[model samples]
Target: MASAETDSKSLFSLESYHVSEEHGFILPEPLEELPPYYKPWMDIALRVPELVHSHELRSHVNKMPLLSSTFLQKHRELRLAHLALSMMTMGYIWQEGEKNTAEILPQNLAVPYWEVSQRLGLPPIITHADAVLANWKKKDPDGPFNMQNLELLVRLPGGESVRGFFLVTLLVELAGVPAVRSIPTVINGVRCSDTEAVARGLEIISKSIEDMTDALRLMQVYVDPSVFYGIMRIYLSGWKDNPCMPKGLIYEGVQTEPMEYSGGSAAQSSLLHCFDELLGVKHEPKSASFLIRMRDYMPPLHKKLIQDISLQPSLRNFVQQQDCKDLNKAFDLCVTKLLALRSYHINVVSRFITVPAARARQLREQNHDSDGEIISRAPTALEERGTGGSGIMSFLKTVRDQTKDTLLPEASKEVKHHS
Candidate 1:
């Protein structure tokens, strides 16, 4: 485990990045005055628009406008689920341990439920029950029923069943919100690079789990559900690093082995390779990465059908020769990578670059450097040499000048005559 001091130093000392409001990156009301942890996560939220526009991600939100009323409805529901599920797991763990801290939670920590929620947001979702009902009513005035009627028909426990109901609804919403769309922002005070921010977020999540080991065991009732929630949140926050998880989940239904980041099924391998090349993320096929993968890895048959082409020697040849088997596939991959790049560029670079001249002046004080100005002034190897040095002639000149300056007039004249 990383020491807290080291982690803190890494985060706070990181180079500061600018945040953008023009691109849906408004500082949340709850986080403006708080510590830095929220900034990284808010940065994640700010990138969702690009995700929605991505060819790879368009299917997730194609039905609605980016962050429209429908999107927000899903977002609210997912956030609610994230909080409720985490809290319920904590409660279950507390009860299972007979309220004993030793058997139910990590040492040196008291708060559990909300703390975990703070660590994981509900995997951002694309659907909401209210949205669906509203849609049904608008399209079919005599719609068969509503969520309330459906719940009654199913005979689920009064409101408790909402979790399960929401679970399915959330999955439907997920079609609109790719696992990659809901990245978890590592909340900290550090000014880190993009890679560092992701690393810190993962580290915090891992630590939070360690701290909750005892609690996790006690929360048997909530284990599977919490795992489901945790797994999704984990991927949403770091899908690029945990690509295998989503890949496995999407293709194999569960993550069983490490994914090959370089190559595999021609369609997928090519896509993953492009994603890595464009995004600089090396996805590993780890156990925790499955759920997110499952969400994206449509089965071979579906992929074939979706591409609107019958598979034969041509598809293979296309993938091998052209480097992409189908137009839709290529389009999707292009969109995904482009959106991912745009998100990073906006969240990590534009925000800082946009800092007002006044603020930049204060930050650099004597330097008076804008972010671009500093970047432009980066040194080159050849520029490192001092102007006074070249070779023997330069050295000789320096020595002569010094000797002449240090000598008395008579001594210098005598030395010159002897020479």
Candidate 2:
């Protein structure tokens, strides 16, 4: 009986060994660095909780030369990453209504922020997609819906204003996890060099992208354009104050400070990044491009898994080798869906930004006297503009056409010309 027990133990050990060997060895990937500005503020928030409540820490953040053209030119990627974190942190806090008044972001931060955001072609407000992809978690020890503990875990040094943003962030994670989680399975299957496995993986990823896209679309109605625009307008006091006004908008803190800089838009969405990675697309290199540094903002393990999967033999390569038209179609379908979602956002934001700008122009023109002497009137607040008009529909269609032209360059010219 003792001999049998020993043999059983040995057999179990042997099976474990074989399994390990079959899987092979993969060194754990290294962690990416967080944006430099993030850690300092986080350290201060952790060590001195009271600092978060005052304007002191915010003043210090404003002092950073994150928005200077020279600095941005030098630290393009890191600066953009920092700008996203800073704005989201501040916007999430201030929008919660902790303090009752609107404050302006100082010029040092405001000008460059607007310029950079424009250069990147992003909107000033944090979109549903941005919050979802940036803050989603694979595992939550606290129940997924538990807001109090989640606030503790996410720990931005803001007051109750963060609650709504936090809730949205949590909702995004809950909505997106199933799709995000399936990514690794797809990666591993492709690594196994099994054509069936590859096909299954492609199907799963395509479906995952579609589901996430649907979840993002649902947010369109829930986001009140007026309220969102109102909040953003209050933060733009510095831009209003600037003689260079309409060049772009700047976010000034509500707590009366002289600091100013540019950039409050949600950084490029992580879903976009995921698409780029999976499709093996590359954009121009900057000192620290969004594609490269955005990973710093992701949860470490999640980022690592994405990196690992990207290094695997690409799905595109596999499709080519197998001559799989179906797989190619699935991949193209995901891209088309993503582009459609982007078009939707462009339409929505054009309503928010372009619609207001157009209205303000019309009001100014209407106020002009017959002699061309303008009768001065207070500018209409963006929120007060009733949601109306085709509002940049033409511009959006042009953008869609350009995107299709760029993304589907190889398709028969007739399809491209149909528009």
Candidate 3:
């Protein structure tokens, strides 16, 4: 119901941002491979898992031809090229695991990857954009978009768990579709003072967020915690803020100095960023800093959408102005659902990262005959922090707690404000 004038003022719609009505932020009909000329990249890309498994990925990459980016003409072609290059880059860097990271990306892989990344406005490293958005294809084109039918186009060190991790994350994005579709209704309803429309929109968003939390449980069913903690996780990690590659990566042909970029993260997903702005969820300085930096990793248009949403009139203020109980309840429910989603995310992180890390620590303790002999400094990069380099447990808890703060107090719920 948002008018053209309102939409123009806001600078976005789902259509403008490539946010799909059905798939939310998931890229539609993603190309599985680039044109025939880019097969050298594809050849290594499709073999990422096998090469990593055999410990020959670096040797193979060293032998790769420095292919040109000129053949990538279409939008999807560039997407696929970026995907191939990103996976190859991640594999090449971490093929020997985190302790033995390759600091310099070979020119054979770096040049065209850099070129394609420049064209796409993405960093020349694996991001959530590469690992999740551009990495899926359907087992059956006409089939349902569920685990059985969905597949990853490119993979890293993790086996089936890699597919599970990325695809389940993809499904979470899919689950967010209805919430995204209802944003305009919330904004427009607030604009027109249509309490009922605003309430309806808020309810849809609440239910959709709940559905997103439910979709997150799929990680338990599909991803092996040990696999996620040990194998696939390293591939997603970047040199920035990481002790492993302290100087960051040198894209051999592109720059003389090392460039830093964070690893792929859930923060890179625009769903929560958009929701945070629309609903006004305030994060603490530490969490807010990481969250804001993540916006830089997102596609420019997607990042702009969140910025535009923040610049608009506040939905929370609009709800605060209304004394209608339905509007009050709707706003409350939306924030409550967001709070629940954040809590659920913490649980998932604990299951996937926290628990595995603790067990690994205990194993390390056991492996050492004496506790004094247990070396604690190494493996701490991933063991204590997330791939994005935030202190994992504290960061998740902070975000979850901040989400709880957005809920309106019971006394304020039905009060008619004069201001």
Residue 352 of model 3, lDDT score? 81
- Tell me model 3's lDDT, rounded to 2 decimals: 0.83
* Pairwise TM-score winner, candidates 1 and 3: 3
Model 1, 250-313: lDDT tens digits are: 1121233322211111112112222222222323333113312322332222232223212112
Sorted by TM-score (best first), the order is: 3, 2, 1
Clashes of each: 28, 24, 0
Please give each candidate's TM-score.
0.19, 0.48, 0.93
After aligning candidate 3 to the native by TM-score, how far in Å is the CA of 86 from where it should be?
0.8
Alpha carbon lDDT of each predicted model: 0.25, 0.41, 0.83
Candidate 2: list runs displaced more than 4 Å: 1-173, 233-265, 284-308, 364-419
Give the lDDT of residue 99 in candidate 2. 34
| Alpha-carbon lDDT of model 1 | 0.25
User: Tens-digit lDDT track for model 3 on 1-419?
Assistant: 34446545643356777677777778888998677877778888999999988999999999988888998898778888888889988888988776788989999998998998889888888778878887899999999999999999988876888889999999998889899899887877877777888899899999999999999989999998877886678788888889888999898989899999898899899999888999889999989999999988877788887898888788888888887888888898898888778889988998888887787787676775533322232255688888888888899888877776677777234332411
* CA-only RMSD, every prediction: 28.3, 13.3, 4.2
lDDT at 119, model 2: 47
lDDT value for model 2 = 0.41
On lDDT, the leading prediction is 3
